[model samples]
Target: MDTASLKKEIIAYSKTIGIDKIGFASPSTFEEMKVRLYRQQELRYQSGFEEKDIEKRTEPSLIFDKPKSIISIALAYPSKMGPKVISKKGERRGIFSRASWGTDYHTVLRDRLKKLEEYIALKMPEARFKSMVDTGELVDRAVAERAGIGWSGKNCSIITPEFGSYVYLGEMITNIPFEPDHPMEDRCGSCNKCVDVCPTGALVQGGQLNAQKCIAFVTQTKGFLAEEFREKLGNRLYGCDTCQTVCPENKGKDFHFHTEMEPNPEIAKPLLKPLLSISNREFKEKFGHVSGSWRGKKPIQRNAIIALAHYRDETAIPELITVMKDDPRPVLRGTAAWALGKIGGQDALEALQHAFSVEKDEEVLQEIRKGLYFFAEKKQG
Candidate 1:
């Protein structure tokens, strides 16, 4: 069997199937990454969204037998919003991170992998294969770095020379012993732009990240946001793009090659007030197609309230009061209370006082008191 010739064939076929970039690497144990993972765990910096099993995450051989090589793939997504984006005066909008702007990359990449796997299976009938996108046990960035897809930028994103950091990564672990490609050099020397621009200082030193402090990680959490992060969140509904947006490598890099990845302006930069009142079914119908909707509407709605507060949107007060008083979830009610305080006025003050009297939940009551304290502090000033 001419394995090298087969590799050439696969690469050619990958281009036909809309894969932006492809690279091959040996599937050895990721020794260095294991150390970093353990350190992140020791510092209690993990987002709790990652796979808990460190051994399974770093060792590809455990996932698939005789895993000789890994084939990493990348798809470029558009970084900028579409032309028809609405920017109104009274009603402000919240931005979803660039990754979540398009149709879910997982679905798109999975389809591409299925095609690659099928093509390889026909060529080598006995070759076993396993593929994963961002959700898989193997760290996508680690695999990408080893596979010569891109260098790991200081922002913790894989910076492809052609696509910058605006690319979706996925990989295939195969039993084929294809020759490995050379990894890209770390080109982010002395550049602290991503680190300095990060809203929550999630970037620790150069490459390490405290996931707990990252606005991207914070946006996905299903509980109450810490007070410090609330103001830092700005108007983001899901994920944070400050690091990538600030990267010099990412400058003038916006690709609209894949049709599935085009952003719907309304969904990507949605009105803050309308999000607070969206029903469960309505949330799904509108935002279920986007990647940011994975945690469902609760976190997004909570963040929307915070975004409205960040904007000091007096127009959103009615919706905020409705959520504060009538919402079933204590997290929402509590967040709404905090936002009302931040966006304070006489009605906001009255609402906080009224809620303080009847709100039974300790957390919500605490938030109401905090809301009223805003006025007290204002009066003193």
Candidate 2:
């Protein structure tokens, strides 16, 4: 089999199926990445969502027997959304970060990878392969960097020249010995824009990230947001985009190549108040198709409550009261109490005091105390 010819054919086919960029890489151990990951682990900077085993994450041979190469693919998603949906006055909207703007990218990229896998299988029936997207053990950014898909940006994202940082990345491991492509150069030198703009200072120095402090990672947590980051979260419902939006490379790089990847403005930037009371069925039906909804409704609803406080939306005081007084989940009830305190008013104070009389959970009681403290400080000032 002419491996070169097969590689050429695969590249051609990938473009036809909506893959924005494709590259081949050797299945060598990611030594540098393993070291960096070890350091991150030592510092307790990991998001706890990644694979725990470092060997399986960095060593290709551990995953696939004598794996020869990895194929990396990038699919561009829309960054510049369509027309804004106007929310009525006294109503505020919460934003889902750009990565979650469209259909769940896991489905989109996995579909393309499956197609590629089939194409390869037809050429060599005995060839073994393994595929992965974000949830997989192998780091997609590391694979993309080695495969020439893009350069690893200061924001810790793969920044392709053509699509910028607004691209979804996925990869496949194979036993085929395809020629490897050259890695991209570090073009982010001297530009501290991404690091400078991180809302929570999560970007340490320039390249490394403290995921525990990152707004993007924090927004996905099921518990109450840390006190410091609650205000930093702004109106983000699922993720944070300050670092990416500030990246000069991502500027003017919006691409609406796939129709399915288009953002419905209403879902991407939904009204904040209504979200606090949305039923499980209603939330699923409206947001089930989007990528950000993968963590389910809890985190999104939690962040929505935090966002209402950020806006100090007086109109949302009643809804916050309902969540604080009646929501079954302690995280929701506690977070609502906190938000009520942040968006201080006579009604917010009254709700917190009432909940204090009947709230059962100890953790929730602590939050209620914090809420009332905000009221006390306000009155004294």
List per-candidate RMSD values in Å: 1.0, 1.2
Model 1: lDDT to the true structure: 0.91
TM-score of each: 0.98, 0.97
For every model shown, the clashing-pair count is 0, 0
Q: In model 1, which regions exceed 4 Å deviation?
A: none
Tens digit per residue, CA lDDT, model 1, 69-141: 9999999999887676664667799989998987988999999999999999999998999999988989999
Give the per-residue lDDT of model 2 (tens digit) for 1-381: 689999999999999899999999999999999999999999999999999999999998998999999999999988888888875557789999888887889999999999999999999898899999989999999999999999999999999999999999999999999999999998998999989878888999777999999988999999877789887888889888888889999889889999888889999999998888899999999999998998899999999998888888889988899999888999999999999999899898988999999999999999999999999999899
Question: Could you tell me the TM-score of candidate 2?
Answer: 0.97
